[model samples]
Target: MNLAERLRRALDAPAPEDLLAGDLIEGASVTDGIVPAAVLVAITRRAEPGVLLTVRREHLRTHAGQVAFPGGRIDPEDQHAAAAALREAEEEIGLPASAVTLWGSADPYRTVTGYEVTPVLGAVDPDLPLSPHEAEVADWFEAPLAFLLDPANQRAIEAEFRGRMRTYYQIDWEGRRIWGATAAMLVNLSRRLNAWS
Candidate 1:
């Protein structure tokens, strides 16, 4: 039906107790000595469905100029991964804490850049304005959730990393590249929704 509908349906469907059982950490599979990060898969509450992605500024020291979902590391005082995600998002994008509704946490993802990131899924009202801090979001846009969940639209690209040949999933949308772990997670979500579809 729409973005909100897709998320609602996904959330409403009967899920195993383990699905909502606990917070996930990405350290298990990620390389040793890597810093762990908590990332969020923030969705929009608008009609015709889409997702919010951030384009980091080119001058940053870390992950400089990367396209990422809005989130950062877990705070010491934060209760869980979702809390860290919402807190980081609000701090970076100025999205009011009350505006978000968390769905559930996805599988922990291991990044090539030595980050063990846990992705949290949630939805928010589409009209709320965003103001990013720390990272300069060159732009933000909505891409249909259905488009991302589609397998035919997904593929991988071979690249060299640290002198080793690596494969990364590339999701090209309107010329934006949603690759690596983000693309894989989107693929996972797409498969989940596709079953329901």
Candidate 2:
């Protein structure tokens, strides 16, 4: 089967188990105040498929300088998760909503930062004109989809957060670090794709 067919089957499959930041939280509850967010997980249609990612601007109040998918809070005007994801992707990375051919959305994942993020998976032409919004995105790059889907690339790392040890998954592509909710979502996607394969 082709890449699009594979992704379509995976997305059409049963909802996967939720992977939450709560797994890393040591003591206190982590799901008190939840905000709705969505991300565009765009797979570049190229000789070797690649996943689009962005390095958030350092000056941003939240998740500054972190590697993230093009996404943000679901606005009141947005109709659904995929709509919000597409809007955010356009606003942040100059990726036109028309350029994305969405396969489907995955099971939502919660982040330690209090956002319940729905990951919208799609495919886009790699040659599409893309320019990062200077204020929101420091830079953008594409990581190979094969590299990201490999279970061996996922690593669990622990760190002290708010005086408690927290564990999270991280995947390093070259020197770019993908972790937190983004990494968790990718892990979930990997499982779905692997199962369908």
Candidate 3:
């Protein structure tokens, strides 16, 4: 099957009941004033598929200099999460919405930061020339999908945040550390894909 078809099937599959779709820390909650956000998990359609990610500008106040997917809080005007993801991708990475083929959305992942993020999966041409927005994105790169989805590469780490011990998944690609909500969402995607397979 083609990449789009495969992605569609994977997304359509029901996530297992035990699958960790959100923050794993105890007492973490998204019930109070939860901000709805969406991210574009852009997969490159090529001989070796990859996932696109970005490093936020260090000067920014929130999540500065951290690796992240191209996205942000869903605006009130956005029709839905998918639209928001597409718009954010365009704004952050200069990736035109027209260039992406939407596969579907994955299960929503809640972060400790109080953002309930919906991940929109899409396929794009591997050779597309993407320009990063200077104010928000510092740099962008693609990591191989195989390496990212591998359970062996997803490492669990415990750290103190807000005076509480929390466990989160981390993936190291080259010198970049992909972790926290971003890595958790990738783990969710991996579970969905593996379930389909």
Candidate 4:
């Protein structure tokens, strides 16, 4: 299927309730219960389809050394989730305005870290040049969307976030370890796509 077709199918399917892993992002100095943040889990159009993922520079202040969708806390100037997601994607990955076309958004998710995150699914041109800002990103990887959504590749792992053990899915791609909130968000996206398709 084409990128648009894949996204169309995903959006058309029935969506599941947003899964909560019990206060996932708690230690950060922010209030709980849904503060606005946005992330772009963008799929690209190419001969071989892929999803864009980023590795944070170990020097960053938050969520450092982890794989993530390019995103951040919502700004007062931001109008909506899609806008924020696109803007952050551009700021973080150097993806241009012409490259991304917004699709539907998934449910709002909360991290134990005090962010009520809006997960955006978008389609982008794979030809765009990408550069991870020196202080923000250490690397970028594009994994095939099919590889990520396949149930065969999914693994359940247990971890303690707030003195509570929770089951989370992990995507171990090549040498990269993709887990935590990014994995959580992808879990929701996979379900949404499954339902939509």
Candidate 5:
């Protein structure tokens, strides 16, 4: 089967137990209302597929200079999570919504920042030219799908957040650190796909 079909099938299956992960996994608590957000997990169509990611501009107030998927809070006009993801991708990276073939969405991940993010999986052409939104995206690159999905590459690390010891996942690629909610979502995706395999 093609990559899209395989991914869709895997995502469609019942998610394995403990599949949901985020800041809460590390003993963080959120007393505020959960904000709805969506991210595009854009898998490239190539001999060796890659996942497109972005490094936010340093000027951003929150999560500045961090590696992240192209996405943001779901706007009221958005019909669904998929639409929000596509819209965010277009606004953040200049990747047209039409360029992505929607597969489906994985389980939602709750961030310590109070965002309940839905990861929208999609397939896109690897060769498509992209223009990064200078205001939000400092840089953009594609990390190999194999590397991101591999269990061994997902590292568990600890640090003190808000004066409490916390553990989270991190994936280092070429020099970039993909961690936090992004890393957790990738780990969740790997689990779902591996479960099907």
Candidate 6:
């Protein structure tokens, strides 16, 4: 089976009991009126697949200058999580929705920032051209899936936040540091895929 098919099957299966990043954040679930959001985990179809990621513009109000998947809050007009993800991808990276074939969605994640995010898994044409949105994205790049899935590449970093120590996972690619919600989602994906391997 193809990568997309394999992932779809795993993602569609029952949720596993693996610990999530949000669980580590103190009072992460105490937020009221959480908002709905979605992100596209767009993987390229190549001999060695890579995942597309973007760096947010430094001036953004939330998660500024952070590396993330192409996605945002679901709009009222969006049909569902997948539709929202596709729209966000096109708006952020100029990647046409036609260039992607969505498999399925992984488990929804609740962020400490009060956004419930659904990760839409999809495979895109490896050669599709991408033009980052200057207003939202600082730049865009791809990381090899094999490297991302390896547990050895995952690092734990901690610092005092709001007078309490908090830990998070990160994966260093070249000079890019992928951490926070982005890294957490990738960890979840890795667990799902690895369970089926």
Q: What's model 5's lDDT at 197?
A: 73
lDDT of 1 by residue, 1-197 (tens): 66556655764464433221111222233447766677777777666557888887789766667677877777688898888888877876777768878778765666666666777887877867787775566766677776876778889667766556666666888988887767866765665565555
Judged by lDDT against the true structure, how good is candidate 6? 0.86
* Model 2: ten consecutive residues of lowest lDDT: 15-24
Per-candidate TM vs. native? 0.81, 0.93, 0.94, 0.87, 0.95, 0.93
* TM-score of model 5 (CA atoms): 0.95
What digit string (tens of lDDT, one per residue) describes model 2 on residues 1-197? 65546866888887545434334377767656788999999998887789999999999988999999999999999999999999999999999999999888987887777888999999899867899998999999999988987889999899988788888889999999998888888888887877767
Instruction: Give me the candidate number with maximum TM-score.
Output: 5
Model 1, poorest ten-residue lDDT window? 18-27
C-alpha root-mean-square deviation, candidate 4: 3.1
In model 1, the runs with Cα more than 4 Å from the true position are 1-30, 195-197
Error of 5 at 14 (Å): 0.5
- TM-score of model 4 (CA atoms): 0.87
CA lDDT of 168 in candidate 3?
A: 90
Q: lDDT by residue for model 5 over 5-95, one digit each (tens)?
A: 6667999888988685667745557757989999999999988789999999999987899999999999999999999999999999999
lDDT of 6 at 107: 77
Is 1 or 6 the stronger prediction by lDDT? 6
List model 3 lDDT by residue over 94-149, tens digit each.
99999999988899988777789999999999978999998999999999988898
lDDT of 5: 0.90
Where in model 4 is the C-alpha error above 4 Å?
A: 2-4, 17-33
**All candidates' lDDT scores?**
0.69, 0.87, 0.88, 0.77, 0.90, 0.86
Which ranges of candidate 5 are over 4 A from the true structure?
A: 1-5, 25-27
Better of 2 and 5 by TM-score: 5
**Candidate 5, poorest ten consecutive residues by summed lDDT:** 20-29
RMSD of each: 4.8, 1.7, 1.5, 3.1, 1.4, 1.7
Error at 31, model 4, angstroms = 7.2
TM-score, cand. 2 vs. native: 0.93
Candidate 5 scores a C-alpha RMSD against the true structure in Å of 1.4
